[model samples]
Target: MPTKPSVLFVCVHNAGRSQMAAAFLAHLAGDRVEVRSAGSAPADQVNPAVVEAMGEAGIDLAHARPKVLTTDAVHASDVVVTMGCGDACPVFPGKRYLDWSLADPAGQDVRGVRPIRDEIERHVRDLLTELGVETEGVETGGVETETEPRA
Candidate 1:
């Protein structure tokens, strides 16, 4: 059996995008990947709107925390995904990195944040493929995960 890959998603604040990404990762990857998410600056709680949107998609992230990003999280992952962190994210060698330029959902309501949320879902779907997680239904947005390790 192929070994499960470990992944970390990072954002400025763990309240929105990263939370959603982490939720999708956990949902689609299931038992296939060790997934986590953190933020350069974590908020006290998850953005409620994000939680609601994810809930609508049949995923529950109510237990997800807004964790502060640490060097340990970076060291623990083979792949680190960043969104809107620019220069605040840590750098590590011998690991793959991906930057997702999705808009921040900090202040947006569900209607306004849906586009960003959908984009994240698309990216998450593609990421699952990259990690070799088999899943159907691709009505999220547009991103695609890696199917195999890059050659």
Candidate 2:
């Protein structure tokens, strides 16, 4: 089989937006893509509201943790998506980079996080299509095993 396309999502804190985006990508793309997420400045844990939001979509993110961004991660990925990470994420030639200006779910409740989660799902779906992966009726599940929460 051909190698799977890899994506890395980065944000200031891996606590909210990035976490949701990463989870959604994995849930939608399954094992067809290599999903990874990290923070420019790692947090102790993922934001509680983010965990709850993902649970609503049937993906458990309670076991996920924040990871510090690294050059290796940027090098390994075919795409590097930034979410409010600014200049923290190094830019490399030949890598597809996208900056998603998503609202931070840091202090928001589950209700407030829902919209952010939905937006992320839409972005993830579009991304899968850009990668040439079919999303028409793919079975959805947590792609956590293939993703390293602390990468």
Candidate 3:
């Protein structure tokens, strides 16, 4: 890993899972890590439900637009995480790759997207640990826990 590890999140559509994952990493890792996200087949806009779910967590995705996956993106990152993008992502030597078997958030409502968003947060936290990034004292966007009641 480089002094500041660069991570790329990829999926079939850049609208939901990848977007959430990248946001969590960026929020949690801050400037300690470089984060990027893309899709094999990019969506025209971000999923509305995803935006709402992330907003509930206090991280806004309203302005985020889907981006297409590129070979150069894969080459530029130290780690590449794929979420249901399957074989669409290109493989290159010396780049660490991880495939997260996450559900596609397409057409899902905010309630349905909440769990996926939290799950991505967990994974992003683990990834930060693996990359030796410290997350202490970082203010999270207030993701709700299972036992917490929705306001």
Candidate 4:
């Protein structure tokens, strides 16, 4: 079998946006891609809203938590995606980097978090396509949609 490509998503808090993106990628890729997420400044736990939103999409994110970014993570990934957290992620010499200007879902309610959820899903889909992975085609449930929320 071919070695699975790995991806790392980074953000300031790692509690919301990046976590959601990581979950989506893992789900869509279905083991064809290795997905990980971390924050420049780690939080104690993931945001409840993020969990709730993902759960609605039939994705379980309860096992996920905020993690601090490490040099090893950057080195391990075939692709490193960074959110709005600027200057926190180190520039690794040989890894591909992508900056996603995603809105933060830190303090947002479901009404507010909807758009962010949608954006993440879209990005996830595009990413899977780029990686040559097939979409899971599962209903987004209550968690996934096309909307943007305040950060």
| Best candidate, TM-score | 3
Instruction: Report the number of the highest-lDDT candidate.
Output: 3
Candidates' C-alpha lDDT: 0.81, 0.85, 0.89, 0.84
Alpha-carbon shift of residue 22 in model 3 (angstroms)? 0.4
* Model 4, span 68-146: residue lDDT tens: 9999999999999999889999997889999989888988887667678778888878887888887656555533454
lDDT string, candidate 2, 63-119, tens digits: 999999999999999999999999888999999999998888989888778777777
**Worst lDDT 10-window in candidate 4:** 142-151
Per-residue lDDT of candidate 3, residues 1-151 (tens digit): 5589999999988999999999989988989999999999999999999998887777889999999999999999999999998889999999999999888889888878887888888889889999999999876555554433245
Each model's RMSD to truth, in Å? 7.2, 6.7, 2.1, 3.5
- Better candidate by TM-score, 1 or 4: 4
Please state the error at residue 131 of candidate 4 in Å: 1.2
Q: C-alpha displacement of 104 in model 1, angstroms?
A: 0.4
- Each candidate's clash count: 7, 0, 0, 3
Candidate 3's TM-score reads: 0.93
If the candidates were sorted by their TM-score against the true structure, best first, what order would they fall in?
3, 4, 2, 1
Model 4 misplacement above 4 A: 136-139, 142-151
* lDDT by residue (tens digit), candidate 1, 3-79: 78999999988999999998788877676789889999899999987887666666777887899999999999999
Q: Mark the regions of model 1 whose C-alpha exceeds 4 Å error after superposition.
A: 136-151
- Once superposed on the true structure, which residue ranges of model 2 sit more than 4 Å away at CA? 139-151
Q: Candidate 3 has which clashing residue pairs, if any?
A: none
- Give the Cα-based TM-score of candidate 4 against the true structure: 0.89
